[model samples]
Target: MSSQETEVLVVGAGQAGVAMSQHLTERGIPHLVLERDRIAERWRTGRWDSLVANGPAWHDRFPGLEFDDVEPNAFAPKERVADYFEAYAKKYNAPIRTGVEVTSVRRKDGESGFRVETSDGTVNARYVVAATGPFQKPVIPAVVPDTQGLAQIHSSAYHNPQQLPDGAVLVVGAGSSGVQIAEELQRSGRQVFLSVGPHDRPPRQYRGKDFCWWLGVLGKWEMAAPPKGAEHVTIAVSGANGGHTVDFRALAAAGITLVGRTNSFNNGTMHFASDLGRNIAAGDANYLSVLDEADLYIARNGLDFPEEPEARVLGDNPACVTKPLLELDLGAAGVTSIVWATGFAVDYSWLQVDDAIDAEGRPRHQRGVSTEPGIYFLGLPWQSRRGSSFIWGVWHDAGYVADQITIQRGYAAHVADVPLRQAATSAQSHTELSERIAVTQGA
Candidate 1:
């Protein structure tokens, strides 16, 4: 196999890796990015066909580039997002090698750098940034039993309603992905059952502003952690059909049955927790809390946004919640498919650097700086803040990680004059908008 050398080697050419390359390039740092597939491979192949970005184009995009040709307020489709990443990489001429998968990364023996082994060849680099992102492995709960003929798929593998087998479909998990998939399947004439779980229900728009805009302005996105009792609650909002709220009651009204969380699958029967009412109530409380926060922000600043009366309405309980089903026999219910909208897990088996990761195989870092020198991580959820996993947030994190690399490489003077975060701020189209985002890094 062929071998190569570089100052820095970045794995995964997704948003995080590309963003790292962009920052490294800005600093005149010599780096090469490797990807197992095409640029933005996850967006191209891992998402559902009807999926769109959760955040508006204006808010969730890289600095120096708006989503290409898409409206600022609109949530670009999956394809558009992938296209935008490809375009962004091209604009900077990022040194990316697609289809080259990094199989192992370890510190070189008696050396200060890493010996990177890839599917194609090997790479020796002084620094390595593992930008594989948060969604490395899709996880289905172990409680899901093996069925003889029932079809099941993780949300990442789901393309559209037609991708599943015919007949009723049971969707487990009530996060953004699960609710969106359930709604889509329901709309496509499939009887859908959505398992309710701890979730945050924020309206897509309140008053005259999108929920994302509210989150940013209210400093919600910059929060270090989720609120108390909501550590695992997923945000249940969507950017489909221009944008809309993901109200469980509203979804139930539209013919999607809402059930409690799937507890287990035994003897060909699916068990459910008796927390449907409690879960919905918790989500409703969160929904109200967001509106209350937004209201408080507007009140304090005396903003001129109008009140949205309809958003305050909490309708009657849905049939499923009122008459909760303790157990479900999929065969009898005619449930032919099960879509697991459960989230993902990280895989760091390839990274053999000591002290870089914890006992649980999770990266041990403050921001993106790992405990191990010359090693770094990017694109982790809450890596710096609540927004770290976001598009723009990842860009900022990449900048921070790049700065750390520059400092370690004895090139501090090269970036001493201007910080990359400030540079990105200066490159923004709107000064007010750029100023609103909390800075994740400094020189």
Candidate 2:
């Protein structure tokens, strides 16, 4: 087995991984990026054909590249964005080893470094950055009762309406993915039923102004300054994780029957929340209200508006009707295709670090540094700022982590002969000390 070495080893070659690699390379850090497949495989294979970014094209660009000659708010197709990433990698001359899958990463016994075992060979590194994004795993609800004779698919597997079975399609989960899939299915002349969940709504254009305008003005995409000591602020509403602003009202207006939360399925009947309309209406109201507040904030901040005669409060908005959660008889409704657009989960089984992750399976790190000394995470939702996981938000986190890694590697070089067991023990003691200080400060 051939053995190779680098200062840092970055896993994955998506937007986040590529961005991190770029930063590391620019800093003159000797690092190697290992990717399990070709670059941008998710965008090429996982996304639907008609799928465009929910946000603007300007927001989607990496650190140094522009999308097209068009305005920033233009919506670039998925393939175009993938092409941008590929170009970014070539431009930077990033040291990426493609088609190399990392099997395990364990601490080297006699050295303060890691032994990364891959299908091709092994790599010894001082630090490892896991840039594998959150969307690695697709989450399908366990509560969804299995049907005897129905085709079921997760949103990841769904490409277009043509893949759906010829019958009424019941889409579970009304998040952005669910709503988009449901809308597409409905447009295809399929009898589509959408299950309403906790979601937000926004018009395609808010008072003739693009929604991205407000987001930019409000500093929603700005990297938040890290909190002092251990004090951290919780996340407020933003574009990335809060919910998607889909034209649900338009979908409802178009004759799509909105259902409630999926409770269970029995005898081919899907049960849903009785107050489905109420939930949808409430969600719409809250989102509009937030946008209204955002508009006010923008005006107060003396920002120029794209739309003249800025939008005013419509009026006292009525709470949407919520019918009692009910069940849909799938067999009676002739439901053939069930698309579970529920959401995604993060899976790190391939990652060998166990102590650094939390109960929710998220990396237990302040910003990106894990409890372990040399392991780090990037591309997590709200990882640093409101939009850390967003295309625009990732650069700051990537740069910060890269700098920290470089600094730490400098310190490690002076003590490279330290034994692994001693280093692990010291790391644990430091973590404990930090926790104690945090608790003391809180008290």
Question: Which prediction has the highest lDDT against the true structure?
Answer: 1
Report each candidate's C-alpha RMSD, comma-separated, in the order given: 5.7, 7.2
Worst 10 residues of 2 by lDDT: 230-239
What is candidate 2's lDDT per residue for 228-263, written digit by digit as tens?
531222211223222234655556666677777788
For each candidate in turn, the TM-score is: 0.91, 0.83
What TM-score number comes out for model 2?
0.83
Please identify model 1 stretches exceeding 4 Å from their true place: 411-443
Candidate 1, 317-369: lDDT as tens digits: 98888998989998898999999999999999999988998999899999888
True-vs-predicted CA distance for residue 396, candidate 1, Å: 0.8
